[model samples]
Target: METINARSWVERFIKTVVDQAGELTELDRRAGDGDYGTNLRSALRRVEANLAGVASDAPDAVFTAVSDGFLNTGGTSGPLFGMWFREFTRSPELTTAALAEAAAGGVAVVQRLGKAEVGHKTMVDAMVPAAEALTAAAGRDEPLAEAVRAAASAAHTGAASTESLLAKRGRASYVGENARGVVDPGALTVALFFDAAS
Candidate 1:
C-alpha cells in the first residue's frame, strides 16, 4: 500500500469533517456554542479546495495553502488553523520527526493564543498527547505514516478522556460544573484532523 502524502492527508481531513459535521455539531451543542462543527466544516472545505493545486511533495506549500485558506475564511477556527499551518511551515523537511515537532509547535501556539493548558478540556488535551506519541514513535524510528497513525490514535483517546475534565476555556468555560463530563468540541476537532492525516 502507498503511504499517504500531505495532499492526501488534507483531502481525507476534508472528507472526514464533511461527513461528521452534523454529529459533531450535536455533541458541541450540549456544552459549547453549538457552532463548532459547522465552523470547522466550512473552513475545511475552503482549505481543501485551496490545496488542490499544491504539490504533494511540497509540505510547506500545503501548509501555506491551509493557513491562507483558513485565514481568508475568518473565524476563531480560522486563526487556530492558521496557527497550526504556520507551525508546519517552520519545517521544510517532511519526516516523521519533523511532523511531530511541527505538531508540538502548533500546540504551543494554540496554548499561548487560547491561554489554556492541559486539563483545560480544550484541543490542547488531544494535541499535546498526540505530539508526544508522534515524538515517541519517531524516536523508535517508525515510518512516518505509522507514527502519524499512532499519534492520531492517542489524540482520539485524549479526546475521549476529556469527558472527566472541566472546561477552562472558550464558551463552554462559563458552564463550570455543568461542563464536566463533556468532551471538548475543539478536542474532537483536533482528533478529526489527526485521524485524517494519519
Candidate 2:
C-alpha cells in the first residue's frame, strides 16, 4: 500500500483533536494539570495558521507545517507532540515502512526526553503500542489502511488501559490515587491522532 494523503491525514487529526479538546482537558484535570486540552487546542490553532501557507500536498511540506505548530507551542505535552510530529518530516513519504519508522522513532524520542516508559500511565503507553502495531503491520505486508486501523485500535486500547494504572510519570504522578480511574490525557491524544489516520 502507498502512503496516506499527507494533507488529508493531518487535517483529520486537527479536526478530531479540536473536537475533543474539552474531554481531553477534563481527563487532564482529573489526572494531571488541567491545561492539556487548552494547550493542545492552542497548538492546533497555530497549526491552522501554519497550514494556510502550505501549497503542497507533499508529506514533508505538510508534516513540517503540522510539526512547527506543536514545536512552537508552550506546555510539556505540546512540545513532546511537536517532536513526535517532527519525526514524520524525516521521510518524504508516509508509506508503510516510513510510517512505522516514524512512529517508532517518535516514541523513542519522546521516551528519551520525557523519561517515560510503557506502564507509566502516560502518552508513552499508547504511543509504544501504536508504533509496535505499525511495525508489525509493515512486517506482515499489510495494506496501509489495515495497518492504520490496527495502529489506531492498539492506541485506543493502550489509552484505555491507562485508567486502571496509577501514574508514574508527568504531573499525574503527583496526585497519587486521584489519578487512578482517570484516563491519561496525553495517551488519549495519541489515540485520537491514530484514529484520525484511520
Candidate 3:
C-alpha cells in the first residue's frame, strides 16, 4: 500500500485523539496533572481548523500548518509534538524509511528538550520503540501501512510497559514510586499516533 499523505495522517490523528480524549485524561489523572487529553484535543482542534487554508496536495505545507497549530497551543505536549511534526518537513519524501528517520529525529529533539530517555516513563518510551520498529520494518521492505502497524504495536507495548515503571521525568516523577501501575499519558498519546496511522 502507498504511504498515507500528510493531510490524511493529521486528520486521522486528530480524530483518534478526539475520540479518545476522555480516556487519555483519565489515564493522566492516575499519574499526572490530568490535562494531557485536553491539551492534545485543543492542539488538534487548532490543526483541524487551520487545515482548510493549506494546500491539500502539499504534504510539506500541511505538516507546516500542523506544526504551527500545535506550537501555537499552550501545553508541554503541544510544543513537543509541534517540534516532532516540524521535523517531518525536513524530509524530501515520506517513504517508510524517511518517516522512520523523521520520527527518530523528533525523538532526539524531545529528548534534548525534556532531558528524558527511553526508560524515563515519558513519551520517549513509546516513541523510541516505535521509531526502531519503523526502521526495522523499512529495512525488511515492508509497505508503509505494515511498517506503521509494527510501529503502532511497538508503541502500544511500550505504553503498557510504563505501567510497571517508576516515573523518572515529567510531573509524574514527583510522585516517585506511586507513579507505578499507571500508564504514562504521553506514551499513550504516542501510541495513538501510530495506531491512527495503521
Candidate 4:
C-alpha cells in the first residue's frame, strides 16, 4: 500500500490553484463577484505559511493548517472550504476508508452550512459526487491513488455539469440566465482538490 503524504497532497493542491487562479476568477466574473480567485489565493497563502510551522507529517496536523487558513478567509466559499477541510482532520490516517468518511463528513457540513443541494449548482454538486466516488472506492478496497482518481473524475464531471445548470444558490443565482454557460468556481475547486489527492 502506498502511504499518502498529507503535506505533499496539500502542496499539490496549492500549486494547482495558484497556476489556475486567473481562470477561476474569470469563471466567477461571468457569474459572481470576481473575488473567488483572490480569496482562494489568500487562503492558500495562509495555508503555506501555516505549513511551515507544522513539522509533523500527520494528516490531522496538515489538514488543520488547511482548515484554519480557509476559515480565516472572508467569503462564503472560504468558510465552506474551511469546514470541509476540517472534516479531514478528524482521522490521522489517510487510508481509503478514512478518506471516504472525511469526504462524507465534509459534504454533510458543507450542505448543512451552505444549504446547497446537488442540483443547487454549488460546491455541493461536485462535493457530493466526489464523496460518493470515494465511498464506492473504499467499499471495493481500492488503492489510495485509484480512489483519488475516481473522486477526481466524479468531481470533474459534476463541475462540468454545472455549466448547463441554472444556478439556484450563491452569487450565480442572482445572475439567473447568465450563469448557465459558466461553470461554478467552487465546483471546479472541489474537482481540483480531488485531483491533487491523486
Candidate 5:
C-alpha cells in the first residue's frame, strides 16, 4: 500500500475545507453563530501558508505545526481543533491502526475539553462515530485508505444525524428544541476532515 504523506493529508484537508467554506457558514447560520466557516477558513489559510516550513515526512512534526496554526487563530473551533491535532503527535505511524488510535485520542481530548458526547449535537457526534468506524476497519486489517474511507462515510452519517437531534451543548444548546433540524457545523467540519483524508 502506498503511504500518504502528512503534506498530502494537510493539503487535501485545507482544499476541502476552503472549497466548502460557504456551505459550512450556511450550516452554522441555521444553528450557530454563523462564523464557523469563516473561522475555519482563516485558520486553514494560516496552516497552508506555514505548511512549507513543516517537516513533510514527519507526521508528528506536521501535526505540531498544524496545531500551532489553529491555536493561534481566533475562534472556539480553532483551539479545540488545535488540541485535537496536537494529540496526533503521539501517533507512531500512518497505518490504519495507528491512525484509528490517534483519532480516538483526539476525540478523548475534545470530550475532556468540550465536555460533550455523542448525541450532544456537537462535533463529538461525528468524531466518535468516525473513530469507531476507523477502529473497526483497523481490526479487520484493512488498508489505511480503506479505513479512512470508512471513517469518512461514518462521519457524514453522524453529522447528518445531528439534524434530528436536539442541541445539548455549545451555543446551539441555548436554542433548545429549536436547534433540531439544523445540522451542527462542527460535526459537519469533522466529517469534512475525514472525507478529505479519504
Candidate 6:
C-alpha cells in the first residue's frame, strides 16, 4: 500500500545509502579501498540533480537519471550499479516483477562487465538470488509489499552467505582465500537498496 512516488523513492534510496555508508565502507576495507560508500553517496547526489527537471511520477525517467548519473560519476560501481537502474527502466512499470527484473538485469550486467559469474564472490552472487526470490514471490501472488520484503530478506541472506565464498571478482579477486570470510561491500550496498524499496 506504500506506493512511493519517484522523488520519495529517490529520497529513500539516498537515506538508505547514507545511513549504511559506514557499514559499506567497513566491508570494503576488508578487501577493497573502502570507497563504495563515498562513491554511492556522490552518485545519489548527481541523481538528485538530474531529477530537478523530471517528474517524480515517471519512475522510468527517474531510473534513467540514476543510470546516467552513475555512469557519469565514474567508478567500478558506476557500471555495476548503473546497469541495475538501467534494467529497471526497461521494465513496463515499477511493479514487484519490474523490481525483480531490474535486479536480474543488474546481475547480468555485472557478469558481462566484470566477467564474474555466480559463486564468484561478487554482487551478482547476492543479487541473482534476491531477484529469483522476488520473482518466485510474484509467481505465488504475493502483494508488492510482501514481495519486496521477501526480496530484501533474500538479499541480506545472500550477502551474509558471501562470507563463505572465495574471491573471484573485483578487488576481492586479488585477495583469493583471504576474502572468504568478509561480505562484499557492493553486495551489501545492493541489499540496502532492496531494504529501501521495501
What lDDT does the true structure give each of the candidates?
0.80, 0.90, 0.85, 0.94, 0.85, 0.77
CA shift of 59, model 3, Å? 2.5
Candidate ranking under TM-score, highest first, comes to: 4, 2, 5, 3, 1, 6
Model 5: per-residue Cα lDDT over 104-191, one tens digit each: 9989999999999999999999999999998899899999888988998999999999999999888788878778899898898888
What's the CA RMSD for each of the models? Answer: 1.9, 1.1, 1.4, 0.7, 1.4, 1.8
Model 5 RMSD vs true structure: 1.4
lDDT of 5: 0.85
User: lDDT per residue, candidate 4, 1-198, as tens digits?
Assistant: 776799999999999999999999999999998899999999999999999999988999999999999999988899999999999999888888999999999999998998999888899999999999999999999998899999999999999999999999999999999989999999999999988875
**What's the TM-score of each model vs. the native?**
0.91, 0.97, 0.94, 0.98, 0.94, 0.90
Error of 6 at 131 (Å): 0.9
Give the worst 10-residue stretch by lDDT in candidate 5.
Answer: 48-57
Name the top lDDT candidate.
4
Better of 3 and 4 by TM-score: 4
Q: How many clashes does each candidate structure show, in the order listed?
A: 0, 0, 0, 0, 0, 0
Give candidate 2's error at residue 191 in angstroms. 1.0
Supply the TM-score for candidate 3: 0.94
- Order of candidate numbers by lDDT, starting with the best: 4, 2, 5, 3, 1, 6
Q: Give candidate 6 regions above 4 Å deviation.
A: none
The TM-score of candidate 6 is: 0.90
Worst 10 residues of 3 by lDDT: 54-63
**lDDT tens string, model 6, 159-196?**
88788988777888876777778998877876777777
Tell me which residue pairs clash in candidate 3: none
